[model samples]
Target: MQPFVDGRYNMSKGRSAEGFDSLLVSITSNTGLTGWGEMAPLGSFYSAAFAAGARAGIVEIAPHLLGEDPRALTRINRLMDTIFRGHPYIKSALDMACSDLTARAAEVPLVTMLGGQENDMADLYKVVTHGSVEEMIANARRIITEGFHRLQVKVGGKVHDDIERVAAVAGSVPKGTVIFCDANAGWTTYQARQFVDATREIDYTLEQPCVSIDDCLSVRRSLNKPMVLDESVTSLEEMLDIHRKGAADGLTLKISRLGGVTKTRQIRDIAVDLGFMITVEDTGGAEVDTAAMAHLSLSTPEERRLHAIAFHQWVTVRTATNAPPVIGSRMGIPDGPGLGIDVDLALLGTPFFETSH
Candidate 1:
């Protein structure tokens, strides 16, 4: 378990966490090569996924993955999908390991396998977890001082209070700094309207104001600022649906939520073609997951890339060496093959579950 740096990550609907349960997986081939993957759900309430369920699913699926060619990414993912239904969160780690393994086999970075490196450094955004008006402003300013111009302000509390928080933070930041008021699916359509109307003059984007697509669309209709959808967008079909309905100006692409790099890359391509601004990130994890997020973000065109998170920076543990270090507000992908970081087995402690043919 990795403790959150801020002590607790408070979000909407009473979802708060002192730490997150991170699950790491490693796959070794006959030729003595290995690939790493990780998945860390925010909490049971935040999504349909939880740590125990992911671990259980992995245990059931791992034995079947033996002897499969890691380089055959599509085939491997298909096999996993065949064995398990609906639980994309469980399949994410295995899919990531396969991608890492494939990239290492080709002696290229994972970004190369995705498309190619399009940005030298992917811009990062800081999340201002739900807090008091003063606390949110202070946290936002602190991260801004660290050179992060983009901020995701966690709202979805009382409509009036959220409006005050967003307005105060926006007022505190420097001109041109981007502010995203992310509710994390915490508001009802009525409350979303109240918040939006109150902050109508503030320059910031609204994100996932409500829990459902229908509610989000209704809110978006009245929203003047750009609206970005998260949590609610769990699949390519949902993304396409959002695009079709023009429900969101942008969407957050969480690698684990969308299964893994394989399916994520597919959705990313389609999103780009459809012209959507994207924030590429994961549910949560240490170095391994951060590496995957960075590679994918780097491969995305910079103009459309809103920002990506350095999730490793949020946790207390170090899961890998040679992990990409955040220099100011931007992070560069590591210059090594595969996910570009070496997982520290020592830090990982011991295997929770193992299988062999």
Candidate 2:
């Protein structure tokens, strides 16, 4: 397990200590080529997934994938879905490995497979985990000094305390900094309304203020600032439903949550056509997952991309060599083929489960 640089990652619903569990999956073809994938759930409470559950799901599904062609992503995903019902988190790593293998086979970067690179560099946003008013402000300032102009401040505590935290941070930050007050679905409709109503004059976007789509829509109606939905959006159908109801001005596209790059791309294309601002990222991972997020974000049109996260920067471990570097507030993808990084097998240790025909 890797430890977080910030010691603990405290969100609205759960807290992660040391760090979260990161699962690294590597697939090797009979021709002696390998592709890598990773999945890291923040915490059990944060999503409907857990590390052990993902492992169990993989054990139940890996045998069926033994002889399938890695390049046939759609068919592979369909098989996994047909055999296993709804554990997208479990299928994410396998889907990612297939994508990496396909791109490597074509001798092109993963972004090329996903509609090409629209922008080589993607802007980043730092999360200010839930903390005291003073602590949160200090974290915000520290992140700004690190050259990140976009900040996603975690709120969703007591309604009044959350209000103070967001207001204080907004006041402390320099002008032109983009602030996103993300509640992570921690509030009720009444609480969300109160928070937005109290902070109406502040210049910042409100994100996932309540638990349900109906509640979020109610909050969005009163919110003057842009509203972006996360956690609550998991499938393409949900994305369409939210868009149809005009519930959100933007959405956070988490690769793992949406299954993997395959489904994420589908949703992304539609989101682009529908004209929604997007923040492309993942649930969490070291290098492999970050690479996938970066490639997808880079392929997205710059004008519509709000920001993407360098999740590798959050952890104090190395899973791959030559991972994409974060230069100031922007990050550029590696020019190499596939996910563009070399996994350090020595660090990964022995696989808990392995199968071959």
Candidate 3:
């Protein structure tokens, strides 16, 4: 699926793109149920994942799951890890498909399979893509007018540009509206520190200002704003390290980075136990990806659930339905069985791969 603004609007890792693309994996169970999954990398630069690598990984792992019980998500995830060594994002598609099938087997929604729903709806947030101060301010104003209370202001450019852009957005948005400046690990420790120092008087949150946990920790000491870790928190051990060190004020937990809902749930549980604020999301994707994230967000306590987005809303294609509706400032999970959305086989075209056991 292509983003509305293409690549000019989304910026990270010193790269920009015209549209986002993803690899979709569909598993057809013997019970005649189909489970869908999506793994989308934002032009291969935002994260370690790329579309090509994900497809190759799936080719290497799919045969192993040919006849395995779809409900054995843990076993499946472990097997994929044992075989692939790394590339959790690639394995995420399979994990999501298995979990979807498991929920279908139980005749329940994915959120119910995850756990009893703690939130009837999920709050939503918007991203103001990296741009000039005026453009970002305009974006912020538009998002706030649309009833969104939370905004993620993309930073990570030159320190002065980032500071000015952030300040502009803050000035434009309503007072008390939540604003987070996400650098996407685009800055050095010094740049991050400088921005934090300059923005000391603003009511804005900082997210992954630098690329490394150590660097971010160094900058954290000088900032009074809440700090959120995104690109740097990739593994369970890393998460534990952050928890042990009190690394940041919150986390941006992506389903692709941690594998899928199974591992994400484990991490979410830990985050809740540590009393850390958490937001669930994927790297980038269409409806399938959003559905998985929505269900996970639904299971999280509202107070701790920062916000999640239906990224598909930014795209032009309709891959699945029953996705969580964005009701004003909030989103809700679909009540349909399993993922609560149906993949449109027609849109997928001819299968690039197919096998039956």
Candidate 4:
């Protein structure tokens, strides 16, 4: 059996600077091979489920890897897919951990193995606040001065309010910088369309303006500016559909959201094939995903300026002493064994292991 440690970090948001944390996993094999991955949804309860998922994935998949060559990762991933159906996220998390170990054993970086090189990076931005026009502009000003022209602002649940939210954030950014408003599915089609119409004359993208993909497309077809799908596109099939139907012109690809790097790459291929924009961003906060997300986005050619990944460690964590994953003005692909990150195990607080037979 392998011992996988979880790093739970409490990070605050720059916009709100509220304390947010996530559970990151460090899976170690008996051979001293270790791979890193971040589990989804931040909370103590979410960590419990993430731990459960990791244990389940490792217990079921690790044995097959015992005598087999770890370099045969493709075969192992395929086996996991076939053996454990409908567990892509959990499987992906496991695959990322194992891939880190495999590449380290071979002394090769994960990017090269996946036919990738460190290039094209993106600057990450987070949703600051939901308030009056002046307040939104103030937040936008602060973000822009902090080297973030790319932005994502929040909107409450109301048609009138959503419109104001869009206009306010748009007016706040430096003349040419990009800005996007995340309704987080807080608007109705009619309400979303009003805001989408407003976006046509601005310098930003619209994300999850409405509820489902169906509603999103309904609004997107009537607009000139492209839309980005996040909560809606959580899988390969969803990505294919969005690209085929033109429901969305871009995507916010988070490794944790789409499982891990393996499937995240698959989604990237799909997006690239359809000539759609792809942004490899993280799910927010101090999860190990920040590093993995940076590497994945930096490695992909299509995700250079289109991606929004940056140093949020300061606000997220009190002390971000680790040189903040810098990649160009935005973020670039990192070169190293596994995710090219050295995790300090001692940083993780009390970690407990739970096994499932």
TM-score of each: 0.98, 0.98, 0.97, 0.80
**Model 3 segments beyond 4 Å from truth?**
5-7
| Model 3 worst lDDT run, 10 consecutive residues | 1-10
Q: lDDT tens digits, residues 1-357, model 1?
A: 999887989997678888879999999888788999999999888878999999999999999998889898889888998988889999999999999988998899999989999978888898998889899889999988888899889999888888888889999989998888889888999999999889988989999999888899999999889999998889989999998899998989888899989999999989998999988898899899999999999999888898999999998988899887788888988878999899877877779898876
lDDT of 3 by residue, 70-180 (tens): 888888888888888988999988889888888988899989877778867788899999887888888888888888899988989889988888888898888999988
Global local distance difference test of model 2: 0.89
lDDT of 2 by residue, 158-234 (tens): 99999999999999999989999998889999999999999998999999998888899998887789999998789
Choose 2 or 4, whichever is better by lDDT.
Answer: 2
Q: What TM-score number comes out for model 3?
A: 0.97
Q: Rate the local accuracy (lDDT) of all candidates.
A: 0.90, 0.89, 0.85, 0.61
Tens digits of lDDT, candidate 4, 116-216: 66564455664555666777688678777767766777763566665776677776566887677676666789887777665567766777877679999
Evaluate residue 153 in candidate 2 and report its C-alpha lDDT on the 0 to 100 scale: 94
RMSD score of candidate 1 (Å): 1.0
